[model samples]
Target: VEPYAALVLGPALLLALLGPRWWDRLLARRGKEHWDSYEALAADYLEALQGMPTLRATGAVGRVRERLERRSAALHRTTVAKLRVSLVDTGLTDLAVQGGTAAAVLVACSSAATGRTAATGTYLLLLLASECFRPVRDLSREWHAGYLGVSAADGITGLRTAEAAVPDRGTVAADWASAPEIRFEDVRFTHPGSGRPALDGVSFTAAAGRTTAVVGPSGAGKSTLLSLLLRQRDPDRGSLTVAGTATAAYTLASLRRGIAVVSQDTYLFHATIAENLRIARPAATDEQLRAAARTAGIDQEIARLPDGYATLVGERGATLSGGQRQRLALARALLADAPVLILDEATSAVDERGQARIVRELAAAGRGRTCVVVAHRLDAVRHADHIVVLDAGRVAATGDHTTLLAGGGVYASLVAAGRTAQEERAA
Candidate 1:
């Protein structure tokens, strides 16, 4: 009877102790699968939301909403199904442990009653059975909790994987003194999923300590050309050299350290004014901060804020007017003090009075630095030492603004059109 008791009780105890580990692994596997599905659905939803403005503008919001709603409903159904399966597995595991203990107890009681086992022996057997099943029950409960944890981990992994697929440039070295001159040698680029190339065999040299303005019609690849210089995307063919070195030779961080950009869309973080300024040059002094603001013609406005430089600029600087945001962006670029500066419609948002002030300030700030300006307003580009006119993704004319205007090509027509529009508006 003693030997029989040990046989039934010892194996039952082992099953209870070991069962939980196996169940936990199974739960984790299932949870990871469910999490991957949920994350894929979530990614799709976020991508659709990002394009919400365009969808709404194009009158496709209803269709987008419907598709997202269907995805959400599917996710709900999957979550509920996983919960149901988990509940069933937990209940079955508990039943198996309890049933095994019950059988052991019955066998021990019969042995004691029949005088085949001592009362003490029966009590020990029961205690051992309970102890063995205790681990099983604890494991079942922990497995349930582990499912949630593993699911969360799986979701994070999916997000990281998706982010990894997005193209990222290599880091540039911190040394700026060895920066190379930027050159575009017959470079061409077409935006992702676009029908036509934005830039086509565009060749140009941006010499050190010189200013170049790219002038063109609305779709003439001016912005695209600048984007290539910024290394936003590599050209389809041809080579881009910086400082006598191909762009691929240096890290992206190294390449960008020598360049600063102030464009029509000036993004400001939802942070204090000082914090935003520090993004360009973390070591800038308070005096340097004030000087940059003053140079951009925004010192008076920033001074009026309740906290001065510490004032929080709301998301994307929504609290500031267009001219103020542009000036702030200029201040940020100025603080960077890179060797090359690109201003793409930097003064377009400002009023004529503000434009005049900013243009004058830029002329002074741009001394001894390479500058590239892209402007629809002829007044802005007219002062640039070299101007290149683009039409249909090609250089239609290249010369100073006066020279191009006198040549009677696309630049001349655009100037005439701009004048006519201004006169009509005045009337």
Candidate 2:
């Protein structure tokens, strides 16, 4: 009877040992295919949705819709493939369990009929055979259930480890009280995953307590230089010094504390205007907030709002006009009172009238700090104490606005192009 029981359990044991491996392989392949297909479909769907306004304007909505449908069909096919694999796995599992049980019962009954075993022994043999396959079934079921979660966990772990590797060395203080000058000597920087250098051997000086304007064509690396100054990135081969010390000597916190920046893409929290301003100077008084707003040329606009300074700024300040958002960003920066002020195309979004007012306020408020202005509009920087023109990642010329115009070089060409565009817009 025991030998008959062993014969019944032998094949079941073999199936249990190998079934999980086969099942997991099928599940893993299907899961990966489904994940990839779903991700592609989702990305395509989001892009189509975001471009719907333009598609409608151009009468291409049908074309976009067709593209989306194709993506959806592909995703559906992958999902169906996954379901088929699961069904096949389930069928295999049932076959192995039922076949092993019937074979065991047949062998045991034959042994009992020949007087080799009694009915009690036959029942015990059947129970033992079932128990042998139980663990294998549980393992196969659990593996399928957790495979997707395992894949997701691996991705998250890699991301966290990569982010943790960037060093944070902001333990030393940077000199900001004296309004130190910034000097870049032969600075070069290449962005990650890019073939070309963003800034190549760029050398210039931003004098202390005076406004310096940087002008260039679209890819002349004006923004790259500002990023280096803020220590957002380190140069590849050259040195960036604040005052007389290398920027690396200062902690990131101390370095950023000395600089205030307002750029074209302004970000505002979903809070009251006063709350946004207080982010720059957390303990500022109401009078201080109003004063900063006045300096930024937005005080009157804020005062006119129904809630005044207490009005909520919708997500990313979307509720406000472009000019108002720009002014609010400036007011927040002003409240910081950093020794270095950076205005990177700060008025690029405002109308001519608002641009003029903001430029005037910028010039007035930048009296004592080291100001760096990167602008395409020549008029905004005409009165700068110094202007540096960059061409193809190198400093092409450096002088006051008038001096560069008189030189008849890259700066002159840029000024001419700017004037032509302005005239065209006016006409």
Candidate 3:
């Protein structure tokens, strides 16, 4: 008993001191994954906030709020449940160790009274027994922390499951010649959660070296057509071909490599201007970066910055104006140098002067590439060699701008609406 006391007391004290650290480490490791998941959710919410104006205008703010609330509640509930489990495990472990130590002391005292051991021996026995259980107590405490970590891991696993369900076409291919030509063969599409189709048997040949402009009203499926071309979503029925090959035959990577897109809602990483441009062409030289910026009419703004192209654009290019971001996106697409280009309302957010410059640049850029422009502005599509008008997800008309306007159908109405909207805004 005396010898045991000497062995147990020293090690027990040491373990008691070190035990909490192990627990803390386990908790930290487990919590890290959950923290990351929460961060991703935060980013999604932030992006939603950035589009608040649009959501409000479209009357989707309520739906957005509801979704946010639900997610937040779920996260909160998960955290609380994990905390409760950890607390219970830790509490039980502490109680068991303390209770066992108390009982051991009583037994040692009884042994000494009955002459089974001396008083000193009994005291030593009690101390030794308490010390022996110290490591077990430490282990119990660690288990609590481990459970906490496990809970965090569980949260992360759930988040990953959700992310997996989202459709993500992998990285685009880098080769150009191997790219496929895009074809819409009687393609029909209905948006997710929408009652009607956005495209109805839309057939078109968007071969290389020609520009095709889709002109239409607010909900005319112009954007949907471009989305299909980009392979963001597949058609509900009929096949889409690329370069004489079916889209389904090629990997998403190979299909997307054949095209580049610039939309009105341009997204920019929180990086330097040069870095942003380099995303389209990672190996591009500084000279090439400057050249692309100049072509996009954003060189002047970049020059004004203290770091020039190296200046950070902040989140989503919030530091820059809408026109600047649009131009930056244009520069990115140009630097990509894909065989096919898609400009979906690319100039909608730009001012009149910026729009004119983009139009001119696009015309020049469209000379030898297959360009598909979805424009709400009449002036943008007026010069297109071929114009396609869509109404209620169907091809309502197809011709040159002048011819379509003369036809005095849906196209004419859209043109009239544009003029009216412009005039009203001006007034």
Per-residue C-alpha lDDT of model 1 across residues 1-427, encoded as one tens digit per residue? 3667666766655665565455555566667767766777888788887788899799998888888787787778777767767776766666667777888888888889999878888998888877877767777777678777878985577787764321455544535463235677888888889999888888877666667888888999988887777767778988887666776666777667778899999999999999998899999999999988988889999999999999999988978898888989989999999988899998888876777777878888888788888999887878887888888888777888778888998989989988988799889
Over the full model, what C-alpha lDDT does candidate 1 score relative to the true structure? 0.80
- Residue-level lDDT tens digits of model 2 in 117-229: 88898888878777777887787688667766764665677787775322466566875676789999999999899899999999889999999999999999999899888
Residues 71-153 of candidate 3 have per-residue lDDT tens digits of: 67766765665465456546555555565566566667667777878988897787777777767776766666565456457
TM-score of 2: 0.81
Better model by TM-score: candidate 1 vs candidate 3: 1
- Rank list by TM-score: 2, 1, 3
Best by lDDT: 2
- Model 1 earns a TM-score of 0.80
Cα displacement (angstroms), candidate 3, residue 144, comes to: 3.5
Q: What is the C-alpha lDDT of each candidate?
A: 0.80, 0.85, 0.75
Backbone N/Cα/C clashes per model = 4, 1, 2
Query: Which run of 10 residues does model 3 get worst, by summed lDDT?
Result: 165-174
Pairs clashing within candidate 2 = 170-251
Weakest lDDT window of 10 consecutive positions for candidate 2: 163-172
Q: Which segments of candidate 1 are over 4 A away from where they belong? A: 1-72, 114-124, 134-180, 192-195, 424-427
